[model samples]
Target: MEEVEVVVAHRDCATLRVGAVFLKIDSDQSRTEVEVRAMALAPIPTPEIRWREPPVLALAALPGRALGRLGHPETASSAAWVAAGATIRKLHDAPLPPFPERSRADLAAEVDGECAWLLANDVLPAEVVTRNRELADPALRPWTPVFIHGDLQVSHIFVADDEVTGVIDWTEAARGDAHYDIATLTLGHQTRLDDVLTGYGPGLDPDVIRAWWSLRCLRGIRWLIEHGFDPSLPGGEIDILKSRM
Candidate 1:
């Protein structure tokens, strides 16, 4: 066996170290990665900024050969959609006994603060800011909150041989409405969600799904306004939000 050396050491709230592997890694490590929660900084109303801890999951690096050389495929098969839904269900069912309790109002306040900062920094257009406020104004009803992987997207997911092997990046994980997670997935996949839910099995209400879809659109709009429009975000996403306004 050869010794591996660290080639990159990147640190933010959580630390990530990439190294050269000397030999073949096992499947278990690839299947089940380590999850670490780290404390991150968030500005508050006070003169001083506060530290808030967010969950961060560590993922094993994929082998060079296994890496996808092309962008996300435009179409996913029905089976692939089902597989993605199952992966999300497993994540939603994960235990988080020590997670902090937060209300919908609390989340709205957080979003408001973020929007304010973005506007102050001239990151978003005035129209976008106004639209965000309108969408965030609706009082969110109290529902059974679950452990949501705040930023669930295709780029953060690891798939091999058409199976979702690992879900990565938990920096945004929190106890919130399940609709948030559903929305995140929908925004990333767009029109393909119908296929996903088809594989998502029965029992989900059509009304609830529609609600989740609306919330997802709102969240994506907020993200784009705050972070500036990234070329990578789906064109349909921007169009949907504009249409909603």
Candidate 2:
């Protein structure tokens, strides 16, 4: 019998791994459309599309292991992290996808909303949330947008030896602040950042990246909690917020 594993299940979407194929079932058809389109536009390797019908997108799993899980140490070599960075550089250099506009003001409002939820729910201590909010203020400044993966979590990247084999999950892909991708990649694995930056080349502002780190952590906590995932997991969302202080 072929093994069938549920990768994740939520009101918005569910992902399943069966044998060598993965099935993504999204409640929103538009998100699936954007994902398929983004994968086609990315300059780097992405999962091969097997079939698409309505809300279900079947993809052939890519070669190699994931770079790492979120909120955990990455066992992949520093070179692999560097290669991942180079892959992102290539994607950012590609033609921008025609996604809807994303504004810093919109992001600030979202952050403010999520932060409010966190405090009201007591998801994180007030001081932690307040400090990270202050840190995130700098990232609210204007930036030159680029083609970004939108959700460049480490698990989305796959690697073999020292090369990036493919990147998965493009639903959130958009033309947005470049630091968003960079910050997403190095969210919990700060130690691997030097290697990634080396391959990403120069002129990236450290403050912006740091600020995005705080912003993403704060922005994601409420959603994760509402979705039934525990953000309090060790080295998870809460840890990411504390690390920014």
Candidate 3:
């Protein structure tokens, strides 16, 4: 008998895998709707949807391994990271998501709210949060919007033999800053950023990318804690923020 593996089980959603099939259960059907719609529109490789019944979505698993994950050392080759970048460029150059344009104000407020919570809760030293807040400011400025993955965390991207195999978890897909995806891809692996940029083409600002790193880690610390994830793990978000000092 094949054992069922629980990939992730948060209050908002849960993913289970049995054999080559993944079962996604979400409390909010709208997210599933977005995932389905985004996959259909994305130009890159995505898992095939086997079935969709309210609250449960079945998908065929892709063949490759995730590029890397947060709080862990990256093991993928430079070529693979570059390939991942090329794959993202393809998606960004594709047509928009057809959904209402996302609000930049809302994104700023969310970051501000998280920073406030970090201070109020004494989550970290004041200097660390304050400094990163200043560093994260550039990300607030407007720019040309593209269809973004919203959460292109390294683990969501898979690669094999120096090529991108697939990208998963499209619930947060929306029209937003393209660099957000680039920043997310290089979250803990900033050293490999040059390789990603090599395949992503030009016109990206490093200052903006650095700012987003602060914004994402600062904003994400709250959710990671609330959802029972440790952001303080050696190379995790906490360290990422402190290093900004």
Candidate that would win on lDDT: 3
Pairwise TM-score winner, candidates 2 and 3: 3
Go through the candidates in order and give each one's C-alpha lDDT.
0.49, 0.89, 0.92
Q: What is the per-residue lDDT of model 1 for residues 1-245, given as tens digits with 9 covering 90 to 100?
A: 54445432222232333342112122233211222341121110001112212332333454212112112445445555566677677655666424565777776676667657657766556686567456645435567766667666555555556666555455466666665565556553556567656655553444455454444554454455444444234444544544445
Model 2: lDDT to the true structure = 0.89
What ranges in model 3 sit over 4 Å off?
none
Winner of 1 and 3 under lDDT? 3
| Highest TM-score against the true fold, candidate | 3
Better of 2 and 3 by lDDT: 3
TM-score of each: 0.59, 0.97, 0.98
lDDT of 3 by residue, 1-245 (tens): 98999999988899999999999999999999999999999999999999999999999998889999987887999999999989999988998887666677887898889999999999999999999999999998988889899899999998889889899999999988888999998998889889999999997888899899999999999999999888999888999999989
Residue 120 lDDT in candidate 3: 98
Residue 213, candidate 2: how far off, in angstroms?
0.8
Weakest 10 consecutive residues, lDDT, candidate 1? 40-49
Candidate 2 Cα errors over 4 Å, as ranges:
none
